[model samples]
Target: MSVEVVIPNATPGTGEGPHWDDSTRSLVFVDITQKNVFRWDSVTGSLQKVHLEDEVGCVVPCKKGGFLVAVGRTIFHLEWSSQKLTKLHEIPLKGVGNRFNDGKCDPAGRFWIGTMGKVLSFEPLTFDMEKGELYCLDVDGSFHKRLDKMTICNGLAWSSDHKTMYFIESIPGQIMAFDYDVTSGNICNRRTVVNFGEFDPTDPENLGIPDGMTIDTNDNIWVAFYGTGQVICFNPQTGKMLRKIEIPCKRTTSCCFGGENLDELYVTTAQAGSTEEEREAFPASGSVFRVTGLGVKGHPANVFNGNF
Candidate 1:
């Protein structure tokens, strides 16, 4: 089977952390290197951009209103109306080369954001892989450290049943699952669900590590490969590869679901470190993709319950 994807907006650098806003019927994403946030309306086919002072890794809608955005080491409640970012709380992982990365709100409305160390560089690919940490912003405005020593904290998703939570530490090249407590917003008993070691990086069939992911109605996991130019699906419960959807870009980064029926799978990619030859090969890199008719629907994104 073949799935056709549409590029709604083109970006300049690394485009990561895609989110679907059910309320506005649009898709939101960030260009980390460009330090810009974008919102693309599904119906109007229009794109809106917002600039920040520093790198913006992720942006998720808040329950009360506006967006909860992770900018460097601090998280803010960004209001589009006034173009303002109201300070919520800042993570203390600063000064150690740590910055916020991919994040999302859990089923219980708690915000779970992860961080990565600036010491790492993908161009030459060198750094301490164990310097980052993942934190949970409680509904009561308190920060709780959950996991530590992460290199690049990426993809985050909760099972439809809310019993399992999936997290990715990008550098390790593996996806981990944990026993999720939806009511308490806790993740424990971590175990590897998907390991990239099984896939050879030199082979085009298995290009690069998984960067970001999304879940379907049937609980299958669809992950975007960083340098692979494809979004592959797997049965997370069984660790079996299900399907691979080739993309027009080389550095596929993240994905989510949007549209009225929530059947459209939106994918994001990166083009920042590409050489001229590489750019000529995959000109569509760093573009937001929209793929439909995958025969699976994804859950609507959860909103942050924390105050702005």
Candidate 2:
């Protein structure tokens, strides 16, 4: 089946991060280029926008009627009522190019977030400023250690059993897995789970880098390709690409399993850095899309406890 772009011409430039909020039964996404947070309900057909001062990276649901949000450099605990946000906690960062990119909470309600370098006008994509790192913050006001040296980190996900952790280093086209100790929140045994280069010999550079990811019940990982026009599904065990859901957009930013049965695949796309002539090529560039009959029921979203 083909994936349909729901919000046609929704965002202007970079419409990046998306998170499915089960509590409100709607999808929350952000336009990094516009610095706007949007909540769109498929059931009621209502769309709302919360304009923020700084660029927003990721937004996950919280336990006590709030959300955990990552702005440019700090992670904040926010309470949203009447579409207004109140700050709770702020986690600081060190790198200039570094900003929070992709994130999600594990089974235990700990938010796992990654940082990436800024796209400078002059510099090409290279490992700069210890660009990416993984961090964990528990619900008990406990701060865990950070994973170091990864550049352009994206696509954070966990296996069905929560024993395996999967992540992607976007530009280099590397997908890695770690032996996750859930109890201690420590990751070990870093090994390559999926490498994108070997899969496609033709036009690897322009095919796009991996962005946001989600896990199916069978432990399959669905990754949105940044420059490529497809969402690739990989078997976690073998790192083999089983399916590719082709989208008609240039920049497929992120995807998640939504809908009542959690079978519908909701995807977010971007028109971030496109030129005038290039924009004419893809009209629905920065839009949200959905596909059904995937047969994967995703886990409900984790809510961050207000006290955390």
TM for every model, in the order presented, reads 0.94, 0.91
In model 2, which regions exceed 4 Å deviation? 82-95, 122-129, 197-206
Question: What's the C-alpha lDDT at position 156 in model 1?
Answer: 91
Q: For candidate 1, write residues 13-86 as lDDT tens digits.
A: 88998899998888889999899988888789788889998888899988888898889888988898687988
Q: What's the TM for model 2?
A: 0.91
Which candidate achieves the best TM-score against the true structure?
A: 1
Assess each prediction's global lDDT (C-alpha) against the native.
Answer: 0.84, 0.76
Off by over 4 Å in 1: 1-5, 93-96, 198-201, 205-207
Alpha-carbon RMSD, each predicted model = 1.8, 2.6
Q: What is the C-alpha local distance difference test score of candidate 2?
A: 0.76
Candidate 2 residue lDDT tens string, 1-308: 75787777677767766777876789988887688778898889888887777778888887776677778867776655555565544546566656777888887778888877766642123445557777777777676646777777788888877798898887678889999877767889999887765224256555567888988888888999876678989997887889889888867888888888788888888887766765788788888999887767777755565354
